[model samples]
Target: MKKHSKIIIFILVLSYLLSGTAFSADIPDDSNVEIVSDEVSAERYARCYDERNYEREFAPGQVFITLKSTTPIVEDYGVLFSEVDVDYVKVISEKFIVIHLVEKTRDSVIDAIDELKDSEYVKFAEPNYRVYSGEAVVPNDEDYNLMNTWHLQITEADEAWNYSTGSSDVTVGVIDSGVSPVADLVANIDYERGINFLDETEPPIDIYNHGTPVAGIIGAVGNNGIGISGVCWNATIVPLKIYDTTNREYYVTGIVEGLIAATAMNLDIVNISYSSLTGDGMLEAIQNYNGLVVVSAGNNNTDLNYNTFYPAALSDECDNMIVVGGSTPYDYRYDLTEQGSNYGDCEVHLFAPGAWIYTTCADGSYRFMTGTSFAAPMVTGAAALVLSYHPDYTTAQVKEAILNSVDQVNALTDLCITGGRLNVKNALLYTPISCGDLNYDWRISNVDVIALARYLENVLELTEHQLSMADMNGDSVVDNTDLDLLAMMVV
Candidate 1:
């Protein structure tokens, strides 16, 4: 009898473990549960689609359900609606599940969802929403000459190159249609590390021919003597394809997924050239990202403050976000080409050359494209250069450097917050200085004189900015002569 009792106790314990403690309590009867209308679920689904203005049809006979985090795996969840003819599709995440109802039972999808919501194991249920990309227009200019890359000179990229041509340690995530490994980008982009979310495990090819040029503008090979130089010649590009060609539009879900993936890779900078009126998911993901995000203020030719666009409007909340507007080669804020650029004192932060911008295109060739899409990459490249120089700089610091170093333009006074155009030269040369403080102790004393003497004697290496500070005579050269002056001043 004693042996039989022990055996029974062990069997009960094993059953509890295997059944996920199912024996602890009985499954609740959902028949008495309140039934909620499908409208609640549809509203949540519509928000994900951003289809408030347009009439959209929900995926027929499909629904998405999320299980509570604490809920343990159970095979019965799949067949919860088996009697109703609904079938479990697959699991999207640990807590999210997809389900499909047969065509004959299409009207029963909502009823199945209501039943699932009433279950104790389910967290919530909603319909699978469809999303599409915003419209991107690029005007063609046939007079494409090598001199079409005048925007680079206007932004002082040529001069900034002397300080830093970007570092291999810096990676810029280009989330767009897709980026092809053109000849000019072969050496600059990290093709092996890139991803195509549109089609899992496939190379991100530029079918729409938009991402390649953007990538070229950001990090095409420099001094190759074959094509125009990119802003950051050495920065690595991580192409993330999110657009779906089948729909001919970018989906909000895809954009959010791309942003999350880029954040996971811990990229130094992310460039988003597309603009939409709704993208709360994208905004949320960006706010949580640790790196800087450069976005385009749409080419809609309107003030974004009143006609707000997302990602650009997200700047109001995300400190790491930089919203770029278009500027003309003549440095005019409201020129013919820039008239279509969106602006707002609080929304749009800075301007860069966007008209007649020359960059690498698909098929291993170069072309002239015009849009705010082309301008955002310039800032992306500049931010990459700054990070290449100071990898330890935080996102906020990099943003401040870019915004504060702009060359103030009067025409941009009421249009943009900075009221100026991007100046990579100024950003590269920005250094907080303290005169007569060679040791950076924030004090001028005999210790500074000794430090200056050591630096001049080549016994100690000083940074370029530090060396400039040691040049107390302001001759732009640090030598023993300056050491003498420092000693006299200290005495």
Candidate 2:
């Protein structure tokens, strides 16, 4: 999913009554968003297909409503359907339902949803939004070889595998078109749990080809004399297809449904290799998710500091989210005139090798692809590897481990918050030290106290990672409170 190519609803939240808990969300209504596209590059990146309008929109006449636990669905809530002029009611989950109003116009749907949301029986109501994958297609010319995969070598995933090759217990949900049963990927997928949210009756298959490489990048089998190795040599990939066959794109409602499915399926991480404008529903859903949600920084080549992009841009509010941008083999951001990686010192989290990436195609073959879409899975695989080694680690620990240990590069200094490329080994072996531990040692002592005092007084300089460690109370600052905490710990 390049820049505006693919739009993904926040697939982190969408759970209703999993383990008998409350419900929350992410979704869209086309009228609420403006699909920003790089007109010059939109055609340039449309390699596999003809150029088409990639404007974002939602499925018409569809309204997603969450029923309060007390409101049973036995009689369609009695008068609620008739009051809102609902044409039909479809069950999305135990507590979620899709209501189709008789009038299919945008105004009618929004107006009807507004009424439904005010009802005490309804917890929330939102429009069903749509998204698409904007990928840059290239010919199947490159002969992919596992050992020669530079993405693996550069990220040091090859070395990380030496310690742990990922775990079967950890599951990664790929929310995209879908993932085909390719040779390198078949053995790593959990077929029973995979589903097509766009059309629940059908199996989730990669008919559009965008998700295959993303999944392959995360967990393609290694040492099998196969095409390419994923970040994790061993892991489970759950195909959660949100593509709308009717429109040849993704429905925000479908992606939100996919997120719920992921939560119910107990997935540890979800990879959304796409971008779109933020939606209220998607934002709330991602915030409620308990696991890590990795997203692409989009391929618009715009600075996210000024522009707004969904899921990725919501990283500040969602702790579990890790937004990624694209980098190149030359150790520089893949910034092109019309299309490239979206960069921001605030919104975007880090960079990954997304250009000229060779991975699996939807047709069970291999090809070279580009976009922030491919960059996300590298981090997904790294997160899976960390979990495979330390299954007990929480999302915060996992995120900190990855963010605090990037391979700092000169070229990435100002592009993103963490101006460095991913280092799989560093992340896999990372164990975040205590906040007061100035030295690498786990203990806080007089030596640490001196370092902190000097740094606070401007007599010394601390790396970004150390500065985080010194902020004892997690208030995003190092002041008197932190000093007190450090002193108490040292004593």
Candidate 3:
């Protein structure tokens, strides 16, 4: 195995050295990357895609309102709506209430909010934000997409779908080798506003076929009989064709451009399934973007604590970014199938199944890929589903929902900070966070164990969510056994 690795590395180095394109040892930016071609393949016409963020949609005549704490919760908003001369929709959650006015205009929502602001019943109000895909439900395309999609079962995404299939309101940008409008993926993509940084004359179609699978994993129109459903069944998939050199150049310009465009679009989430060294252009663009960004920790088996892969390394600087490493179907941090997934305490944040993973193909079929590239989209999809449940959640909260809910495993114990693999159902549970986070800090550690001990002794108070989290054994009671489990986790 070592000889094979040395031979492979030697070959790669020789090829690059001969081509005069060997990556610099000084930094990992793609300035010196060698180009292959800019021509795009005519695999098929277009299919899936929607420009949601481009033409931001709002629910007409509907306003989302949160009542003051002092006011009583109105189960029946009939009287209140009658008084305000508006119709009541349904209670979204304790965070927000939806009400539809007779007048159907963006102005009506503003006017309604203005009128209700004075009412003691109203604490704050805004338009019921809508876009291409906001509704959530379980999908029927599970059988078709699940043929080789064991990663979903590994992370419990199939169960999480019961909570939210995904929302069209959310837009996730796939800035990789571009995407193809394949039959399975065509139904969920938004083609109206795609950006091809490599070529302007042609659409951002897949010539290398990397982003198609990533996009399919995130939002491939659930229940459309598209063969596979994405993590976000209804969310819009915007193809941000920044770099089509997944197999060739490890460039940074296209990635930088994609980040800029995503920031301008105010995209909800983005998936960058590549790895490069940290540089100014990448850091500046990442820091500037307010939305959540999920990036792949390179497929190399090196520890990122010392090497520091770009966007994955940037996770320390940007709380909104999630650095995903590849795991196996059995949740091993290193997949022997290819170069093992990268890891680090400070860089690679978490692991998802990436070994021999089956997903949508560029030619509108399904294929298997093994790398952090494929794994990153699983995290991106999980993040999208969390946002679909609560669009109001901050990037920090959404990030915690995914990170804190990881399933602790021995293989990942020393590989990454989380020391666990993705658990989609656990992540979707509660408001989100902490395998045993009794203190409700969105993290599980000694502090939580201490809090749990105190709670057992009747010395601390915990919220309903915290109590649920404290039930480490799922026996419906927070006992010393649960406390013991929490303490073991901290250690």
Q: Give the alpha carbon lDDT tens digit for every residue of 1-491 in model 2.
A: 12121111111111211222000112222243222222232222222121111111457788878889988667564366666887878877769888887888777766786577668778877777653232211112233333236567667676676667888889999999989999988999887899988777888889898999999999988767757778887898999999887889775666678778887877899999878875546776776678899999999989999998876777766768898999876567887677999999887888988876778998988876778999999999999999888787777667867887888878898888777889898887776545565553335666666666666667667766567877876668887556656665544
TM-score of each: 0.58, 0.62, 0.62
Per-residue lDDT over 1-491 for candidate 1, one digit per residue giving the tens place of the 0 to 100 score? 13353245335433433564101222233343222222222322221122221212357677777888877776655555454455556777778877776653334655666667667667887766554332211112332222555666667776677656788899899999888878778888787778888787788888888999999889887776567778888898998898887888887787787789988999889999999979877878998788999998988899987997888878866767898998766555534544588888878889987766778898887776778888899899889887776675667557766887888877788888888889887776554223455543323566666566555546566666567667756667777656655554443
Task: For each candidate in the order shown, give its overall lDDT on alpha carbons.
Answer: 0.71, 0.74, 0.71
Tell me the lDDT of model 1 at 197: 89
Give one digit per residue, the lDDT tens place, for model 3 in 1-491: 12353245335433433463011112223333222223332111011111122123577778888877766666687466554657556777765678877788877876776678777678777677653331223456644533355667657787777666788888888888788988777766777767888776778888687889888888776677547677777788889887645455547988999999999988888899988765557888987888899999998889988886777777765657888899865556754654788898667778988776667888877766778998899999998888887776667678887887898878788887788888877776545434575443355555666566666667667766567767766677777666655555554
- The predicted structure with the larger TM-score, 1 or 3, is 3
Report how far off residue 334 is in candidate 2 (Å): 0.8
TM-score of 2: 0.62
Q: In order, what is each prediction's RMSD in angstroms?
A: 30.2, 24.1, 17.7
> What residue pairs are clashing in model 1?
133-250
What ranges in model 3 sit over 4 Å off? 1-147, 244-250, 432-491
